[model samples]
Target: MTSTDTATREETPSAHVGPRFRPDIEGMRAIAIGLVVVYHAGVSRLPGGFVGVDVFFVISGFLITGLLVREVTTTGRVSLARFYARRAKRLLPATGLVLIVTVLLTWLTVSAVRWREFGVDVVSAATYVVNWRLAARSVDYLAEDVGASPVQHFWSLAVEEQFYIVWPLLLVAIAWLLRRRPGLRPRRVMAVGIAAVIVPSFAYSVYLTSANPATAFFVTPTRLWELGIGAFVAIGATLWTRVPRVAAIVLGWAGFVAVVGSGFLLTTEVAWPGYAALVPTLGTAAMIVAGYTSGRAGVAGLLSWRPAVWVGGISYSLYLWHWPLIVAATAYWGELSGWWGLVVMAVAVVPSWLSLKLIENPIRFAPALSRSNRLALSVGGNFTAVGVVAGLVLVLLVPSTSAPAVTGGASGSGVSGAGALSGTSAPAGTVDSLAEVEGYVPSVVDAEDDVPPYPEECQVDQVSPDPVVCEWGDTEGDLTVALVGDSKAMQYYSPLDAIAKDEGWRIVSMTKSACGFHDGMQVASGEPYTSCAEWNDAVVENLLDLSPDVLVTSERINDALTDPTDVTTRSVDAMVEAMTRQWTTVTEAGIPMVVIADNPSPGDVSPVYECIADNDGDLAACTFDRERGTADSGAAAQLPAARAVEGVRVVDVRDAICPRSRCVPVIGGVLVYRQTSHITDTYARSMQATLAAALVPQVEAATEDAEGS
Candidate 1:
C-alpha cells in the first residue's frame, strides 16, 4: 500500500493530522533544491539546472494527488476547504516571511522608482498572478538584459498556488463520479485524464518553446504536463509495486541518470517541457515509483538519510527565500558576483532553515488550535500580510515633495534656472507652463487630429512599401511619406504616425527588425545584410517613383560598428557614406529629409525596476551612470556620421537625456529609463516636447525657405 493509504491507527489530538514524515520524498527534494542552488551560484557545469523546478512540480503533483486519491478511496468526499487550509499552513508562513524581509531590504537599499516597480510585482505575487504579469511584460527570464525583480522567481510559486486552487475541485469531482459509477475505476479515469492533459500540453509547449520561449517558460498552462507526469505515476503505484527489486533499482538509477543528464544537456535555447522535459519529469516519477516498489533498502536508505531529509524538509522555505536574496545581492553588487554570490545563497539558507524549524513547523503541527481556528489563522494571516505589504508599497510609491526642482541648465551641463525654456517656447503652442514642459516634452504628435489623413488604397498590414503607399492618418489620406530603417525605426511608429497625421502624409513604413539603412553592414540578428540590402533597394526605388514630399529615417549604423578598434574600417566608413547617399537621394528628389538619432544601447537590467524600488526614492543610487548607459562605441560613431551630412538635420534627444556629464536616467519625477539602457515609454513621452522642439523649427524653416524659393 502507498504511504498515504496507511493512516495512523492512533488518533492524535493535534490539528496537523497527516503523515509524520517521508524521508525518501525529502531526499528527492534535496536533489531538486541542490540543483537550483548550484545552478544559480554559477556552477557552469549545470547550465540546465532550471529543470530542477520541473522535478519539484512532478514531486508535488504525485504527493498531493496521492493524498487526495487515498482520502477519497477511504472517505466518500474530499474537503476543499480543509485541503486549502492545509496548503495555507504549508506555503504561507515561509512566503510571508520572505516577502516582508524582501520589502524591508528593498526599502533600505532600493531607489524610489525601482521600489514602485517591485511593489507592483509584490502585489502581483501576493495575489498569485505573477505568471500573467511577467508574460504581459514580455520578460525573458533567461536574457541577460532582464532586470532584477525581487519577486520574479515567485512566478513559479504563483503557478503552484493557482494549481492548488483548482486541483482539489477537480479531485473532488473525480471522486464524486467514482462514487456514482461502481463499474468505472478511479485509477483508469485518472490515467486517461493525465494522458489527455499531458500529451497535448507537451506538444503545445514544444511548439511555443521556439516561437516565444519566454511565454512558454513561465506560463502555467505550458508547464502543466510536467505535473501530470507525476499524477500518472501516483495512480499506477499498485502496478509499480509488482516489479522485482533489481528491476526497481535499475529504473531508479536510470531515473537519477536522466535527471542529472537533463541538467547538463538541456539549455536556454532548447524547447522546454516538450520532449526535453519528459527526461527529468518522467525520471523523477520513475525514481519515486522505484523507491516504493524496491524491497532493496540501498536506494531508499540513501534517500532516507537524515541530512537529505532535513534539506528536503526545508526545501520549500529554501526555494522561497533563496532567489530574492540572490537577486537583491546581485543588484547591490551590480553584477552576479559568481563565487561571492554563493556566500549570499549560503547566508539565505540559515534564515530559511530557522523559519522552517521555528515558524512553519510549529504552526503546521500545533495542537492548541482547533481545525476552524487554524483555518481562520491561516487565512487571516495571509491576507493581513498581503495588506501590510501593499500598504508599505503605497508609502514608497507616493512621490516625495522634498525632491529639488530640476531647472534648465547651461549647454551640456547641470540643470540651471537661467537656461530654462520659457513656457511660450514649448512646441505645439498648447502647453502653457515652463514646469509642464521642463522635464516633460510630448513627442512630436499627441493625437490622431494632429496629423493628416491617409488614402484607403495605401493601407497595408506589413511594414513594407509595394507601390510606395500608406494610410496617413485616422482619415486614411494617401499623401505618401516613407518610414525607413530597422526595429529602431519600428519603435518610432507611435511618434511617426502622429507626425504623419499632423502633416496629412501617408506613412509608407519600410522597416526590418535590426536591418538599418546602411548599404552592406550586418543586421542586428547577426545575419548578413542581403535581405536588408534588397529591402533598402526596393524602398529607395519605390520612394524615387512615388516622389514623397519628405523622407524620414533613423540610423542604426551603430549596430554594425561593435568593435572600438575597427571604428574606422573601410566597411564601417562605407556604411556611413551609404547613409549619407540615402540622404542625398531624398534631398536630390526635392524631399525634406529628417534623420532621428538611434537610441542608447541595450543593458543588463531585467530587474532594474526592482533595484530602484529597493533603493527607496534615491535616483542617484538606482540610476546607471552615463558610461554604463552608452558603453557602445557604435552609438558615438553614428553621432559624428549624422553631423557630417550638411543638409540633414540630426534630431538628438541626448540633450534632453544628458544635460551634462552624460545622461542620468531620472527626468521630471519619474525614472526616465526602464532598464539600465532603454528609456521607458513614460520617460520617452516626457521628451516629446524636446523632440518636437528640435524637429519643428527645422521642418518649419525648410517649409518657409522652400516657399521663398
Candidate 2:
C-alpha cells in the first residue's frame, strides 16, 4: 500500500540527475508489489511475503530523500508548499479514490456490525494516521480475534506519509544547523540526522517487538528505522559511484537475494521488522546503491526488463486495489481456496489498471494543477474531504436495535435465553426473525459487545504474568469456589457467581486470556507463550495456598507448542499429560476440581453476528456442523486428564449451547455467542439456574469429600 509515485511518475526521481528516471527503482517496485500480492493471495510458500512492505519503505525513503536533497543543494532552501503540493498530487488522488471505493465495497458486501469500525478506519486512513489507530487496536485483547479490516494495508501508507511530513522538516533543520558552518558538508549533517532517527527507532523496535509484538507491527516508531535506512543511501549517493564495479555487482546480486529470500525465509511467526527486518531493508539499500554504481549490471540489469517496469508502473494502484478485492471476495464466497484467491488477485489487476488510467493519471498530469501549487493542494484537500465524508456516511449507516437483556424468566413469564431450552417455558423469540426478534436478549448487531465486564486486574491479557484475584458472590460465605484457566473459564463467571450467591458460597476468579491452567509450554504468534506459562505457575501457586473447596477450569485445548528445535507442533497426548499433572497437584492439596467442558466455537462459521444480520429470517444460514465447530474445543483431551486425577470431575453443559448436532445462531430467545466460543453475558446469566441443577451437586460432593479428608 505504500509507494512513492503512481504509474506516470514511475520514471521520475534520480539520485543525482535531478528529475532523471531510474528504471532499476521501477523494477524494484514491481518486485516489492509482487511479493506483497503473492503473499496475501494465500501462497503458503511465501510466509515472509509481508517483508515486501519493508522493501517499499526503503524505496520510498531513498527516492523522496534524493528529490529533497536535490532541491536543497540547488536552491539552498526547501520549498515546503511546492514540495507538499507535488506529494499531494502524486499520492492523494489514488489514495482517496481507493479509500472511498473501499468504504462503499465494505457497505455492500461486509456485515453492518463491522461498518462502524471500518468507517472509523477509513477516516484514520484519510488523515494518514491509520498506523497509530491500528497500533492501538493490535493491543486490544477483545479486538485481537476480529477480522482484518479491508483497509488495513493503509497502515503502511500512513507510516510513509508521516515520514514524508517530518523527514522533510528534519532535513530542513539539518540544513539550517549546517548553514553557519561552511566547513561541514550538508550530506554529512544529514547523515547524522538520519542516524539519529535510525538508531533509537531500531533499538526501540527490537525492545517493543519482544515486549508487545502486536502493537510493534503497526507503530510508526518501530518502522522509522526502515525508512531511515533508505535515507542513509540517498545522503551518500555521490560516494556510491566510487564503489568498485565488481563490488557493485556483488552487492546488487547479494541484495537481490536478501530481499527476495527474506520473503521465503521469514514468516508471520517471527517478531516482525525488529532485527529480522534488516535483511530486506538492507537488501533494498544494497540494490539501490549498486544500481547507482553499475548501471544496467547484475541485479539492476534484470530489474530493468520491460515486464518488470510495466508492473512497477502500476504498483501503487495494484497495491491499493488488491486488498479490498480480496476482503470483499472472501466476504461474499466464504474463505477463498488458494486458486480462488489467485483468481481474486487477478481480478484486482483490471481495477488497478483502470484506476491508474482514469483516476491517477488524469489528476496527476492535469495542466491546471501543475500550473498552480495552491490549486493542486486544493484538489488534494477535496479528495481527502470526499474520503472523510464517505467514511462517516458508512458509520452513520450502521444498523441499531433496542433489544433488552435476558432476565431468565419461565417461557410464559417474560423470560429469555437458556430458560426456553431448559423447558421452563416456551422461548420468547422462536418464531421471530433476527431482523425483528422482539424478545431476544441482545440484537445480532450488538452480540459481540454483550460480554460481561471485569476489573482490569481480574482477567490478565497476553503479556502480564501476575494473577489478580476478584472475589464475587457471597464473599463472606464459608464454602469457597475458585474459577480458574483462560477466557474459556472466565466465560462461565456469570453463572458461577449466581450459583455462589444462591448457595451461600464465595467465588474467586483467576483467569488470563489464552493461558489455560496447564503445566505445558504454549505458543502464540509463533513465539513461546512465556507469560502464559508464568501466569499458569502463579495461579497454581495461588490455588495451592488458598485451597478453595472446588476449582473450576476450562480452556481451548488445541494450543500450539514448541519442540526443542523451536518448531511449532501439536500433540493431544502432551496436552492431556500437562493437564493431568497440574490438576493432580491441585487435588492433592485437598482442593477438589470441576472441569467445565469448553464450548463449540462459531469462529469457523461465517462472521456470526453479520450472518444473523443478513439472514434474520433464515437463521439456518448461520448454522455450522457441530463436529467441525467443536473440533478444536479440546474437551476429549480434557476428559482423559479429568478421569486420571482423583477428586476431580467434569460438568458437561454443552447441550445448552448445541441442543441438536448442529450449532445454531440463537437459542431460547437469546444470542448464544458473543464472539468466537465465548457466550454473551446475558446468555451465561440465563444459564445460572440450568447450570446450578448440574453443578451444585458436584460442588456439594467435592466439599463433603474435602471436609472428610
Candidate 3:
C-alpha cells in the first residue's frame, strides 16, 4: 500500500505501525465524530451520542499500543520522547488555535461574568488537565447553575492525553521487568499489565458513577479502562487469525449495531463510562478484530465508504472546532433551536476544514519537525504557550466592577431593599424612576456571591441522601421555627435569621440544592433524583419527631417530577399533590407551617447578572415579564397546596419582587436574584420587615391552635 493509504489507515494521535492501512478504522472515526457532533448540537434524537468519545478512546488505545509493541519487539526498548513528540505534532496545532479563538470569542460575545471562569477553564484545557477542573466544578453546589463552558468538551481530550502520557512508560516498565525471563514474551506480560489497569479502573468507574456521577463523568481514572480495552485487542491481534469467518462476520455487524445503537438507546440520564460504557468500547474492539480477521467479509464494506473516510480524515479538527462555536453562537443569540444548532455545526466545518488543511496537516507532516523530535516538541510548546497567554489575557480583562460591602437586612446605608416597596422604609439613594441598576447594594460582578452565609456543612448537596440540621439565632428560646425545602427556601434564611433573633425564636434549617422537600421523586440532570426522595423522607421523619412549633417551607418546583406511580411528567398537578400530602403529615404532627411562595425567576435569560453588566446597568433591559416569571414559579402549586392543608399559611412577597406586572432585577438598592431562580442574600435580607409583617401573625395563630389542641 502507498504511504498515503498507510497514513489514512492509522489516523489519530498515535498512528498504527501495523502491516496494512485499515480503511474501516478511519470510517469508524467518522461515525464517532458524527455521533458527538449531533449530540452536542442538541439533536434530540441521539441523547447517548456522547459515547463517541469512549469509542475514540478505544481506537487510540488500539493504535498506540500497536505502535509501542512494534517498536519494543524491533528495538528492545520503547522511546517516550518520540512517542510524545508524535502525539504533540499530531494534536497541538489545531488545539492551541481553537483555544485562542475560543478565548477571543468568549470575551467578545459572552458576559464578563463568565470571562474569569472561562479563562481558568481555557488554561486547564491548554495544559491537558481540564478534566480534573471540570470534575471539581461538577460537584460544586455553588456552580450548579453555571452555564456550559465554551471549552468544556476538552475534558475528553484531556483524558486521552493523560492516557497517552502514561501508557508508554508503563509498557516500557513491563517490557524491562520481563526481559530477564526465558519463556515469557513481552506481549503476555503487557497483557497482564493491561488487565491490571482495566479491572480496578472499571470497578472504580462503577462505584464513582453511582456515588457521585457528576464528578465521575469527568475524572480520568473512570475512563482509563476504555483505552485498556482497545489495548487488549491490539496485544491479542495474533489470536484473531484462528477465528472463523462466519463468527467474525456476525461479531462485526453486532459490534457496529452496539456502537451506533448506543447513541439512540442511552441518554444523559444514564451514569456514563460506568458499566454502560462497555457496549460501545467492546463493540469498537469487535470491529477492529473483525477487520483484521475477516477482511472484506467483515463490516468494512459499509464503513469504508468514501464519505465516511473523508469525514474521518477531518474528525479531530471537527471535534476541536464544533463546541466553542456552539457556545459562542448561543451567547450571541439566545438558546439555539434544533435547526440553529445544525446551522452552527455547518458553520463550524469552515474553520475545521481550514485548520485541518492549513495547520494540522502541514505541521504534522513537515520534513523538519517530522525528522527532529526536539523541533516538533518545541513547536508544540509554542502553540501551548499561545493558548495559555490568551487565557491569562482574558482573565486580566475581567472587569473590575467589585463593589464595597453593603449592610444587609434593614440596610444601615439607607438602602432599604424590599422596605421601599412595602412603604416601610426608603433608601436615600433609591431612584424614583427605578430605570437603571446603578447604586445596587451588590455590584453586578459580586451579585453571584451575594448569597446567604450558612455555617459550613449546614446544607446537603445534590448527590447525598444525608440530612443536615443547622440552628441559628436563639438556640435557647421559647418557640422553635424550622426552615425547610430546597435552595429557594434556603435563600430566605437571611431575613428569617434577623426576625428569629429579634423575636427570640430558635431557627432550624434543613435544605438541599436542587431537591424539593416533598415526598415525590424529582428529576435532576434528566434522571430520577432518588437521593432527593430519600432526603425528603429522612428530613420529614426528623421534623415530625422534633415537632417544631412552625415549619417554614419554599421551593422552586419548576422541575418535573416522577409521580408515585412511576410516570415522569412536567405537569404541576403532581407537585401540588405531593406538597399537599407532605404538608398534611407535618401539620397533623402539631407543627404548623408557613409556605414562603417562590420568587420570580430570571426565566430563559442565561447568566442574568451578566446581562445586567452588559447593558451598562440598564435594569430595565434585564426586567422579565411578571406573568411569565410568576407562572413558571412554584407559587402555582404552593398556593393550592397551602389551601389543602389546615393551618398552613403562604407568605407571598411577590408584589415587592415584581411591582406593576414587571419583575425587576433590583428593588430599592439591592440586586434581587442571585441565580436563575433563587433570590440573593442581600435582597432577601432587605425584605426582612415585609416577610415578618406577613409571616408573624400567621405563625402566632398556628401556635395558638397547637397550644389549644
Candidate 4:
C-alpha cells in the first residue's frame, strides 16, 4: 500500500508473473529460526525471542499467497491438491522424521509420566492440529502446568498448515463466486476476503487476549491478522519509484532492528501475539519490502550472505531439532545456562543437517515423489508411521504394573514404608509409597485431579456461569462438609472423601476451574471473570440457605487476590478485604469455614517428574528451594483474610509440604507434587492422617460452634 500511487495502475494491463526464489526471504527465515532457537535454548538475552514465530507467520503469508495469486492470475485456477502436495513434500518429510526420533528419544530419556500426553502430542503434531489441542489445554488450570512437549514447537507449523488449508479454499471460493465480474479481479477478490478476516480477527484477538490470554496465544483466529498482513503485501504488490538510497538503508536497518531487537526488549509476561506482535510482523514485512528496492545499502546484502542463506535453507529442520534437544538438555542437566545452552544448541545442528540431507532433501526433491498423488500417499504413510510410533511409545513406555503400592511400602525413593525419613512421626504424611509419582507413571501426568470419581456434579468450568450440582460423601451423614473454590480446592477431594466416609460426614464440593473465591479479585485475563463472580454469588446464596456444618474452601490464591499494582506480590490486605465479604455471609449465618492453606509450588519451570526421569531417579536433584518454591503461593496472603472473619479457621500445610530446607519431590515415600503446584490425589489422600490430625480438631470445634448457633 505504501509502494505506489493507485491512479497509475488504472490503464495498464497487469503482467502476471511467478515469483523468483528470493535469497533475502531465506535470510529472513534464518533470522526467525535463529531467534526462536536461541530464545528457547535460554541462551539469548532477548526476552522476546518468541517473536521469531511472528516473523515466520508474515513470511508464510507472503510466500504462500504470492504463489496462489500468481497461479490465479496466469491460469485463473488454483489446484488445492498440488498446493497440499508441495506443502507435504516441503514439511512432512523432516517433521515426521524428527517426530519419530523425538518420540524414541523422549521414551528413553524423559519420564514415563509424560509419555501418555506426549503420545497424544505425537498424534496432534502428525495431523497438524496441535495448536488447537494446545489451546484447549492452555485454559485447563490442571493441564496448564505440565512440561512442554518436545513437539510443542509444532504449534507454529500447525497454525501455518491450518492457514494453508483454509486460505486457498477461501481464495478459490472468491474466484468462483466472482468469475464473471471483471471489476473483481482474483487478487482484488482475495484482498477483500482477507481484509474481511483481518479486521475481525485482530479485534477478536485483542478481546480474547484480554479475556483469556493463554487460549488467545495458540488459537488461529488470533494469529490470523499477522498472516493476513503478509497476504495483503503479496496480493497488493505495487511497482513504484525507488526511495532515496539513504532513506531505504535507514528504513531497512530500522526494520531489521525491530525484528531482532524485540527479543531482547520484550518479556513473555506481557500478553502476546496481540498488539505487541506488530513489532516483529511489521519489521518482517518492512524488511521484505525494502529488499525489493535493489540496493546493497539495505539489509539485503547481510540477509543474502552465504551463512544466512544456508541456515535459512535448513531452518525448518533446525527448528524441529532444536526444541526437543533443548527440552532434553534442560531436563537432563537442570537449567542449561551460559555456555551450556549454546553447546546444547550446537549439538542440534548435526541431527538437523542429517535430517535435511538424509530425510528431507531426498524425499522432497526426488523425481519419483514429485507428483501430487505420490506426495499425498507419502503424507498418509508418514502419518500412519507416526501413529504407530505413538501407540508403541504409549504401550512400551508405561510404568510397571507390579510397582508396589504407595503406602506402607518401600520403593525407589529408598525410604521404607510411608516415611522417607525415620525420625519424624509417620514422616508427616501419606502416599501409597513414593512409587506413584516415583514410578513416573504416564497416567499421573496426563490425568488431572479434576477428572471423574471424586466429584464433578457441582463443578463449573472457566466460562460456565451455571454450576453443576454434584454430591459426594456419605449420603445420609449427620454432618455436612461443603468444599468450595477453584480446582486447588478440589485437590482436597480424595482426602475429604476418605474423611467423609470414615467420619460419617456428608461432603458437598462447589468448585470451578481456575476460578478463585476471592470476592475482590474478579477472575479473567484482565477483565472480570463474570461467570466466576456469578457462580460465587450463587454459592453465597446456597451457603446462606444450606449453611453446612463446616465450610472448607481454598483457591489458587495467587490468581484470586493478586493485585498487579502491589509491588510486594503478597496482597494480604486486598485478599483479606475481598475474602472478608464472602466469609461474612457464612460468618453472619454462624457457619464455620476453614481456609486450608494452598500447597507449595513444585516449580513450574522444573517439574520433578521430568527431572527425576532425566536424572535417573535422583530425588535430591529434583527438590526445589523452600523459599523460591513457595514464593508465588497465595496461601500466605490468604491467611489474614481467613483470620479476619468470625467463625473462620485456618490450616496451613507449608511445613508439611516444604518441611526441609528445600521442597523434596518425594516426601514420606510419596510424590509431593503431581504437576507443578497441585498435590497428587494420592499424596493428598495419604496426607489424610496428618490432615485429620491438623484439621479434625478445628473442624470439630467449628461444628460445635455451628451447632451451638
Candidate 5:
C-alpha cells in the first residue's frame, strides 16, 4: 500500500499554505512506513506492523480532503481535470517507475512458471485496479496457497487511487448543492457529507469485515471508512479552535501510544478494517490533530528528531524499494527470518536513496511541470506510453514459461522404514514416464482445465444454499457414485471420472468451494465460513433424494482447520464426528459410502513446482522430507473418521504419491501434483489404473454387503 504521500505532503493545501512544514506529520509518515516495511520483512516483534497502512489511509484522507476543501473554498468552483492532473503529477511517476522496475526484476529473476501470473499483476498494478483484483483472488480457493507476488503491495496504492477517482467529483457535487442553500458554509456542508459517507461505509465495512475479512482487507469499501474518518478530522480541524498546551500534549502522547502499541497488541488473525481498525485509525487521526498545535510538544517533539525526519524524507521511495528487495532476498535464501529480514531492509536503503534523489523529486517538482496543467497531462500520457511498452516487453520476455515440472522417472519400488508395510504400502515400481511433456503453471491449468468440474450451479460457492447435482462418466449407467464435499472432495474428479467411464457407472458431483462433507463449520480468515453449514444440510437432503448406489466424500483437511485452539486435535475430532454422522444417513438408507484419502501437500508454503522452477532442472533439489512434505495428508486426519462410519470403506492412495521414503516431486516422468496439493489432470489420468484398482473393489464390496444385508 505504498502511496505518493509517504515522503512528501504536496497534496495538502494546508501544507502548501499556512504552517507549511509540519515536521510532526512528516515524522508520522516515517513511523507508518517503518511499521509496514518491518512487518512485511517478517519482524517477529511487530506482527501488527501492517496497521501502518491504516495510518497511511487516514493521513491520505486527511490530506486529500484538506486539498479538496481548500479548492472549493478558494475557487468557488472545482476543475475536475486540473484536480486529476495534479494527482497524476504527484502519483503516477513514482508508481509507474516502481511497476516498470518490479516487472523487469520479476521477469529476470522469478521462476519462469510464475512470470505469467506476476506479469498479469504488473498490468493490474499499472492500472491501479490491483486491490479489487487481489480481493477477488483472495476468495478463490485454488489460489489460496500461492506465494506472495512482488506487486502485492500495489493493492494499497490501488485503494487510494480508486478513492481519488470518485472523491473529487463527490465533493464538487456537495459544494454545488451547498451553494444553492445560502446559509450552509462549505465546511458545514462538507462535514455533513463526510458524516453521511462515514456512517454507511463504516457499517458496511464492519459488516464486510465480519463476513469476509480476507476480501475486506483489500477492498476499497472496507477501507473507505478509515479515509472518511480522516476527512472528518480535516473538516473539523478547520473549525477547531486552539487548545491548552497541557491537554494537547496529553493527546499527542496518547496518539503515540495507540499507534506504536498496536504493533505489539494486535495480530493478523483478527478480522481487520472492521472495529479492530479503530485502534490505529483513531490514533493516527489524534496524532495529526496534535501536530496542529504550535511548537514541539509531546509525540510531535519525539517525531521531530533528525533521524526520524531523514527517514521520513525518503519514506515514499523506501516503501517502494524495500518490498522488491525483500522478495529478491527471500527468493535467494529460500526464506526470510530474523537477521535476514533486517539485512534485506538495510540493503533496500541503496535503492531507496537513489530513487528519492533521482526519480521522485526530479519529476515531481520539475519547474516546467509547475506552470500549467501540461505536466499533469504529459505525465498521464508518459505513464500510458511507458506502461504499454513495459507490458509488451513482459509478454515478449516470458514467451515460454517453463512447464509445471513433470519428471520422467518410473514409480519408486518401495518405502524403507522398518514398520512400513510391504505389498499394499510399498511404492509402485519405477516411475519412468512423464505425464506432461513440459512444466506449465499448474494453478492456471488447474483453474481452467485441471478436470471436468461440474458447472457453477453444481460446484457450489458459499452463497449457494441449493445444491445442484451434475453427472458425467456414463451418466446413463445403472450404478451411481455420488461424490460429495468441498473442493478437496471435488479434486478426485479426474480419476473418478475415468474409473466410472471404464466401469459403466454414473458419477454425480455434489461439491462446494470450501464446504467439506461434514456438518461442522469450515473456517476461513479466522471466521466460521458463512452459508456452508446451511448448504451442508441442503446437500445432505439432496443426496438422500438421489440415493446413489455408492456415496463418495473427501475434503481438503486444512480448510476444516479453522479452529484457533489446538487445531490438529479439534480438526481431527471434527472430521471424525462429522463423517460418522453424515455417513450414518447413507448407510441407514442402504447405500455404501467410500472415502478417498486426501493427497499430501508438497511444501510448507512454496509448492514443489515453484521450488523445482527456482532450482533449475534439478527436480531432486525440490524433494522434501516425507515427514515434513507429506506431513499431514488430510488422509491421516481422516483415517479414524472413515473407520468410525458404518458401511463406509476407505481407499488408500498415499503409496501412489510418497512411494519412496520421501514424497518425490515427480512420478513416472509425470508431475505428481499440478497444484500445491491436488494432482494434475494428466498425472491423475496416469494414475487411473491404480485408482481403479484400489477404488473398484471397495465400492463393489460395499454394494455387495448392502445387498446381502
Candidate 6:
C-alpha cells in the first residue's frame, strides 16, 4: 500500500500547519457566520439564516476528514490522543476564557433564579454535552420570543467535538483493514465508509426530523451524514483535481450561491434534513469539490483575499462568541432593536476576533509543552471545567426545603364581604354594588346534559382530570364555579379563585394539556381529540342545569387560527356556539354569563422568562410588549368570531393588564406574568382588584335587568 502524504505542502504552509487554514473555506465561514448573525439579529428577510450551521458541518467534515486520512496513510495509525490534543489546543483556551467571563457577567447582571439556570447551562456547555442538555430541555432554537443565551452557540461546538471523538477511531479501523489488504486504495475504503455511514444516518435523520426535529438538529448521530458528504470529496481529491479551471470556477460560484441562498429562503417551519437541507449541504459539497478540481486562478484569487482569510482564521472563535453576546445583549436590553442591536453585534465581533488571536492561536503554537503534555493539559482542563460545573448543578438540583411566605391576609385587600359595601363603594343595584351582592349563582350543566368523562388513557397527569375536582380559593364553599380550558385559562385560576372565596364561591377546574376547547383537532396519537369538545359541552350543559348565577369561561382560541382548517377552529367555533346556546339557557334561568378573553401569548415562554430572570429586574430584558399577547395576525382575527355570540359578554382584560402599549411582566410590585406566556398564580391573584373592577359592573347590570323583567 502506498503511504499517505501527511506533511504540509510547502506551497501552502498555512493549509497544513497548526492552523491548516483555507482562504476560500474561511470566506465560506464568513458567509455562514454572517447568515447566522443576521438571522439571529432579527432580520426578517433571511428566514433560513439557520442553515449556516449545515454549511459549517460540511466544512468541518471536509477539513477534519482530510486531516485524518492524511495522518492514517502516513503514520499507519490515527492518533486519537494527538488529534484531541490538537483540538483542545485550538478550541479550549478561547472557550474556557469565554465561559469564565460569561459566568462572572451572569452573576453580576442576572437574578438569583436566572443565574442558577445560566450556571447550569454553563456547566453543561463546559462539559460538551450542551446539545443533549438543550434537546432534553426542549429548547426551540427558532422560537421568536425566547431570550438569548450567551452560551447557546456552544451546542454546535459540542456536536463537532462529539464527531471528532468517533471519526478518528473509525478511520483508524479502516486504515488497519486497508493495511491488511495491500491492494485496497485509501479513497475506495473511505468511499465505502462514507456510504455506509451516510445512507442510514440520512435515512434516520429524515425520520427523526419529523418525529423529533429538535433532537435531530442537535444530536451528532442524526447530523453525521452532512459531514460524511464532505468527507467523500476529501477522499477523492485526486479525481476532482482533474476537472478544468473554468468548470471549477463555475461550479464553485454556483455552489456558493446555493449555500448562501438556502440561508435566505429556508425557515424553521420547514422539515429540515428531509429535503430542504439538501440545498445547503449539496451546495457546500459542490463548492469544496469545485475548488479542489479546478485549481483555477479566479477561484483561488477570490478565496485567497486577505479579508476573507482573516475572518476565516477567527471563524471558530467568532462563531462561539457571537451567539452568547447576542443573547446576553438581548436579555439585558429586553429587545435588541433598531441600530442598537446591530451595534451590539458589531461590538461583539471585536472581543471574539481578539480572543481568537490572543488566546486560540497561542495555545496551539505554544512551544513550552511537548505533544504529550499538551494533550494531557487539554484533557485535564476540560475535565476540571466539567467537574466544577457539575458540582454547581448538583447544588441547584437539590430542591428548596422551605415554603415561601404569602403576603396579604384572607379577604385580602380587594376581596369584598357580603351585605356590606366596603371602601368607596357603588350603591345597591349599581355595577359597583355587585361586589356587595350575596348569593351569586354559577351556571352549571344538568345531570341529563352532562357529557361523558374523557377516556382515562388520554389524560395527562399535570394537565388533565385523573386528580379530578381541583379546589382553589380557601377550598370551602357551597357555590362552585368550574374553570376549564387550556394553559391560558388555567393561569386565571389564581385570581378567580381568590375572588370566588371572597364572594363565597367554590372553584372546580378541568384543564387539558395544550388542548384548546376546539372540536376537530386530533390527540397525540392522531385519533380524534374528543375530550376538549366533550368537556366544554358538559360544562355548558352542567351550567344550564346546576343554575349557578354566573358562568365564567376563559380559553385561548388564537392557536386555532394558525391554520383555518385546523381542528382547533372547528372545536373552538363549536364551543362558542355551544356556550352561546347555553347562555340562552342561563339568561332564561336568571344567571349571568361571564366570558373572559384569553390572555395574549408570547411566541416563546422559557426564553422570555429566562431573559427577564437573567436581567435581574431590568425592564429591557423582556421582549414582548406587556400590553399585547401576540403580534400574530392569527390571534387578532379570533376577536370578531368570539364577539358575535349573543348574551355572552366579552370581558377584555387587555386594558387592565396592558396600559401603555406594552404589557409589562410586573405591575404594582406583583409580576403580571409568571412565565413568558402565563401569569403567575400569586401575581394573577394580586390582579383580583383589577379583574373584579372590570367584571363586577357587567355582572350587576345583567343581574339588575333580570330582576326588572
Predicted structure with the largest TM-score when compared to the true one: 2
- For model 3, the local distance difference test gives 0.80
Q: How much lDDT does each candidate structure score?
A: 0.60, 0.81, 0.80, 0.70, 0.71, 0.58
Please rank every candidate by TM-score, starting with the best. 2, 3, 5, 4, 1, 6
lDDT tens readout by residue for model 3, 119-234: 98999999989899999888666786668999899998898888776788898887677666646787788899899989999999999998889889899899999989988887
Tens-digit lDDT track for model 1 on 1-709? 0001111122111112343344677787888888888788777878888888888888877777777666766686788766666666656666677777878776655544445557777877766777787875553211223355777778877776666666677777778888899788777876776787778878888886655565677788788777777777777766876778888888888888898788888776565656778888888888887876664463666777889877776787888788878877776676665577678778878988898789776766666423575564565467547735763674565454223434332223443221232342432211122134233211111110111132323322222223333443334655555667654454445445666577665666665544566555453222243445566677778777767545667744454443423423435566666666666666666766667776554243323443434444333444344454454424454555567765566676655555444343344433344432344444444455566677656655654544464
- Highest lDDT among the candidates is held by which one? 2
Evaluated against the true structure, the overall lDDT of model 5 is 0.71
Q: What TM-score do all the candidates reach, one by one?
A: 0.73, 0.89, 0.89, 0.80, 0.87, 0.66
Can you tell me which runs of candidate 4 are displaced by over 4 Å? 1-18, 239-254, 387-395, 405-452, 455-481, 494-508, 514-516, 519-550, 555-563, 566-568, 571-585, 597-644, 650-673, 676-709
lDDT of 5 by residue, 96-141 (tens): 7777888777776676666666777777877888788788778776
Which candidate do you rate higher for TM-score, 3 or 5? 3
Tell me the tens digit of each residue's lDDT in model 2 across 286-400: 9999987676667889998999998888998999889998998888788887678888888888989898889888898899988899999999998988889888998899866
Q: Tell me the RMSD of model 1 versus the true structure.
A: 8.4
Ranking by lDDT: 2, 3, 5, 4, 1, 6
Residue pairs with clashing backbones, model 3:
none
**Which pairs of residues clash in candidate 2, taking residues 3 or more apart in a chain or in different chains?**
411-425
Query: Candidate 4's residue-wise lDDT over 1-709, tens digit each?
Result: 0000011122112224333456777788888888888888776587788998998888878777777777777777788877777666667767777778878777766767677778888878877788998998876655654668887888888888777778899888876776667577676678899998789989998888766778889988898888888888777665312456676677778889999889789987778777888899999888877766637768988998879988887777788888888877776566778578778788898998997889766776677666556666666467647655664566466664223344332233443322334365443332322333444322234324323355444567676666655567787899988888887787777767777888888887788877777565554544446677778788887877787888888876564445534333445566667788878777788778888888777664355565665555665566666766666676755777776787889887667666766676666555566655776665665566667777778889998887787
RMSD of candidates 1 onward, in order: 8.4, 3.6, 4.0, 6.4, 5.1, 10.5
Off by over 4 Å in 1: 1-21, 139-146, 295-298, 368-370, 373-398, 406-478, 484-503, 506-551, 555-557, 560-594, 599-709
